[model samples]
Target: MRSPLLGVWERLRQGSTSFLVDASLGALLAGWAVVDTLAEPALAPAACLPAAVASGSVALRTRAPMAMAVLASVGFLGYGLAPGTSTPLWSFVTILVVAFAVGAQLRGRRRWAAMSVLLLVTYAVQILDAHRSPGELTWGEVFLTPAVLVLGPALAGWLLQRARRQAVDLRRLAAELETERGRYAAAAAEAERSRIARELHDVISHSVSVMVVQAGAAEQLLPPGSPAREQIRAVRNTGKEALAELRRQLGLLGTGGDPAPLPGLDDLPQLARATGATLTSEGVPAGDTSPGLGLTAYRVVQEALTNASRYAAGASVRIRVVHRGDELELDVANDAGRPADQRGSGRGLAGMRERVELYGGSLDAGPREGGWRVHAWLPRRSGSPR
Candidate 1:
């Protein structure tokens, strides 16, 4: 639907002040032609004088388009007084250009009124001068010429306004796209950070729980001269194991290497043994659980054991891992015999709940029958959990 020539013309119009320049040059050419072809010697100077003035008025088209229009109208009337002059016809082109510019640049009702007056005056003067018969100034000709002049500019201005509105809409769409992209990036970053926090908590809490259990056992069993040497050795071995696990977990955060091995369901028994908590496993085989689910299961148990050892040290703990049908379930319970001073501020329980919820699972932690219990169920996929 687009023409290359029209595009080129519009580009030229935009790039230079040539519309008025071309109009002025055209007026001068028409005047010269009229002087040579239509004007007699006596009227030639007068016939060409209005054309010269109309040509010069083009310079003020943008600055004072209404004034230029009035000047061109006057030129047309002056040229009409000269005998055998046809140069006044060309002045109408200048008057049209000035009216269009005025309508396009000025705002509101005033601009339309000014354009209407200009067109009406130009049409009246041309009709009165050009017609010879008494009935030559018909209503049809009077209305038609001015309508053509006014509507041409009004149509151009309308198209220009539409194009401007489209450009503004495009800019707003681009800004909204940028804003949405930024929000997506921020959400992605927050998700990654939460994953890392969960991983760190699992690794450190598991190691610390093992250390606490071994240290407590060593303290209780090491009495003078009653087979205390083996208990001392076991404590030393447990301490070394805890330290080694801590180092391995920290090394996974290295920048230039593959990630360290992550603990999964296979490591749950060892985890339970280290914490001195009784562990029971049931339902589907360990191989059936996905890597992510296994990792989450191990961490939940690890957090549970750490909480038990810290706040309920001497209490017996029971830990269970069950894969029932399509879901994995975990439960840890320990007698809450600690004095009020030894209880936690509930941050660990809240953290556990948050971690479970991230994988589309649900967790419950509270006191149960003179003991503390933490239970969680994680789904095989995101949509449903048990």
Candidate 2:
């Protein structure tokens, strides 16, 4: 449970403009005097002076607690020895409040020194009063009374300072933790983007170079105006176009760059023909697809075709696409070919899976019926294909 002094310290921390807190303490001291005067009319005059001194100075407790404590302590001690009167209880309470404030507000050796002086004065008063009335009160009562009054508030103030320090430390640590978390997330995202960029470069540069070299060689051998010669020229032109597109896409990473058009399901036919794979489709719509879904679908096909060229070259491959109203599905299967250590670094399939799953899609790839099959599904937006 929280201590009462800690609760008071929290109120002081608020630093309110209105002096309600100080006024309340002053009111409490006056109230005690009024009650005591009603109970003992003969002692009223003697209590009034000390009461005024203690209560009137309470307004400066937070700003000048040490000074207030000294003033209040002296007034309390003087009232106790006043003729025809005992110590005013309210005056003693006010002194404790100031002592607690001193311990709480002051820092380092100053706090300890101030509290030490206050306690010493309190004991001196008790000793002098006891010496005046020898044998009336024992040394134990003299020790215990000052000890309780002096030590209680000081201990409470020390506890309050410690608790406030701990709370500040916890808040600072929490802010640091949040900052680290955001930095880590941004770092991870940048790393992933770089990885994807590298993979695209590898696939495009290798495939397009091969196509260009093969088409040029065929054109050199074929006769002019031949149908096959025209097809060879088309192949060379297509490879150049694809390479230029890939370069434009890479440029998008720079400042003030225009985004390159991403190939989608509509481009699958050309992609499959270029990769020597047969293409088939069902329920595929014809207008613009969402950029995210289209890019994901394009990457899925690209990765699968690149894998086939590596693991199953010269093999017959078939690619199937099915467009549902809310999602798109793709499958690429190829018959086994010359198996020349086609087991990849596994990054290709991992990248493809990452792309598909990013859009709440699923992917599956494994050997099936003496061939390999890659399948994926991606969520689709409600729009016509481009």
Candidate 3:
């Protein structure tokens, strides 16, 4: 029951037009007051004018509610004690409406003070008016009049204002709850990513260390220039490279950034040779480049060559880097080789694409001319913000 009443009150608070509700209310009360004046043979139509002024000013209740309430109360009492006029029911009703408006619209200490003054002033006026006519006066009627006129509507309006404040607080709390939920979810995802990075670092580092040790033992046991010693040397070199990569990954997981300087174009030849690929370049300089761009370029070549080594082992691979004015381009192509039974996690290619796209670049990787190709174009400009 309480909820339904609150909903109704909320609907009424929503505006229709400029004072449409207030103006309609004022007009109705004025008409009723005029009717009451006409019914009283002693009261003239001129008496209706003051009542209309008092009631109609309620249209400005939201703008000046205290003034409206005071005007209505004064007009109702003053005219009630006029030379030959009687108080009308509509006049008292207008007083009630204006009193409620004062409580609902006025904020802070001013509202309570205005309400108290209205009650006190109305009480004094009623008593003075009754004292002028000796036989018609009663204590109960005087007290009841002020209580009914001031307390009822004012309390109702104050209660409504409190409810409106509570509704606003509830909405703010809900928004805060949603924000907290999103923050918690993000934190959880980051923690999980770090956990996976740590696990990979531990497992891969231990495995690579064991393989390097075994390869070194084999190379030492074999006679110099033996065919098997060369293979063992290659295995040891690959294990060392894998260990370096594992350290880099560990640094990223622990510190959230690369602690060591990233490999750039200079390392491309070694990267290509490790994967048995031929490295070539055109128009690119051997000097310094942007850290972000260089890191992205290195990763692109690394991921492509890694993919070729895993999925197309013993294949003929080619890597090319080109430096066009305002752009850097990369291409890695590999002919089909012995098919591997296992596939990758797909994260390496995705990470490469993400890195390229971060610099407003483009990447394309797919089958082309009986071989797999990965191509990327990254932007470069002097004085560009990193």
Task: Judging by TM-score against the true structure, name the best candidate.
Answer: 2
User: What TM-score goes with each of the models?
Assistant: 0.46, 0.55, 0.54
Residue pairs clashing, model 3: none
Alpha-carbon lDDT of model 1: 0.68
**Per-residue CA lDDT of candidate 1, range 1-386, in tens?**
99999999888679467666756655665565355534455466656666666555656555566666666666666765666544244555666665666666555675676666667666766576546334755667667776777667755754665677789999999999999999999888766655564555455555466666777677666676666666766776777777666556545544223334578889998998897899888887645555556787787889888888887777899998887677788999999756434667677778778767877888998899989999998876542122
- The true-structure Cα RMSD of candidate 2 reads 14.3
Deviating ranges (above 4 Å) for candidate 3: 1-18, 128-134, 220-237, 247-386
Q: How are the candidates ranked when ordered by TM-score, highest leading?
A: 2, 3, 1
Q: Report the lDDT tens digits of candidate 2 across residue range 1-386.
A: 99999989888767655367776776777677556745775665756676566555566667676667666666666565555454456656766776787767777887877787778767877787787678987999988987788789888988898899999999999999999999998888776665556446554555577779999999999988889998889999999998888767765643124333557666888998888889988995635565456667888999998888888877899999987778788999999887655567789999899888777788999998978999998766532222
Assess candidate 3 and give its lDDT: 0.77
- Give the distance in Å from residue 174's predicted Cα in candidate 3 to where it truly belongs: 3.3
Question: Which parts of model 1 are misplaced by more than 4 Å?
Answer: 1-49, 53-89, 130-137, 191-386
Candidate 1 clashing pairs?
Answer: none
Residue 72 miss distance in model 3 (angstroms)? 2.4
lDDT of 2: 0.75
